[model samples]
Target: MHGYTTDKDDYLKRLRRIEGQVRGIARMVDEDVYCIDVLTQIAAVTKALQAVSIGLVEDHLGHCVVDAARRDPDEGQAKVKEAADAIARLVRS
Candidate 1:
């Protein structure tokens, strides 16, 4: 794969933070925290997750998909299209 290399440590750090956020949300629910506060945390988690997903997709396109296309035009095109569709879905979500 020719994609941009992601720092595994960095990704893991983000995931751990997200996990903590999730736990915090659970705690908030148990404590009966305000609805708005809970929702705000949820939004933060959502944005964090989206960032990770976008980073992964971008890396895939920069490395694996592009490399594949370079070696085989048809396969590369298919991969690119698939990536585009995934991006669209991500955006819609």
Candidate 2:
């Protein structure tokens, strides 16, 4: 099972909330709402996504990476590298 399996439902709920926020932003644009207000909502959505990403990363490291290390060092190293790459992408985003 994936590392975040236990928290999968929570993640889904958070993602759904973020999705709604995005739709709201689109609605604001369609309504020609104030630009700054729209931008503020966009920022909020971005932060919310980042928060989810961080939680997933923590779960991965705590569960997946640790389990791999217990099973095999090489597998653990691979997982670590994969996780590092993922984090790099997140940071770049």
Candidate 3:
């Protein structure tokens, strides 16, 4: 099982909340809400998503990478590389 299996439900719930926030932002745009207000909501959603990403990264490192390393050094290295690439992408974004 994945490292995050235990916390999957929590992640899904957080994602759903972020999704709702996005819809709300869209609605604000449609309603001609103040630009700063819309921007603030967007910022909030961005931070929420970043928090989720960080959690997933932690889970991946703690579970997947550790397990792979125990099972095979080569596999562990690959997982590390993969995770590093993912983190790089997150950083660039």
Query: What's the TM-score of each model vs. the native?
Result: 0.89, 0.97, 0.97
User: RMSD for each model, in Å, please?
Assistant: 1.7, 0.6, 0.6
lDDT of 3 at 18: 97
Candidate 2 C-alpha lDDT tens digits along 1-93: 888999999999999999999999999999999999999999999999999999999999999999999999999999999999999999999
Residue 1 accuracy (lDDT) in model 3: 88
lDDT (Cα atoms) of all candidates against the true structure: 0.90, 0.97, 0.97
The RMSD (Cα, Å) of candidate 1 is 1.7
lDDT of 1 by residue, 1-93 (tens): 235355567888999999999999999999999999999999999999999988889788878898889999999999989999999999999
Across residues 1-93, which tens digit of lDDT does each residue of candidate 3 receive? 898898999999999999999999999999999999999999999999999999999999999999999999999999999999999999998
Please tell me which model should have the higher lDDT, number 1 or number 2. 2
Clash counts for the predictions, in order: 2, 0, 0
- Model 3 TM-score relative to the real fold: 0.97
Instruction: Kindly give the stretch of ten consecutive residues in candidate 2 with the minimal lDDT sum.
Output: 1-10
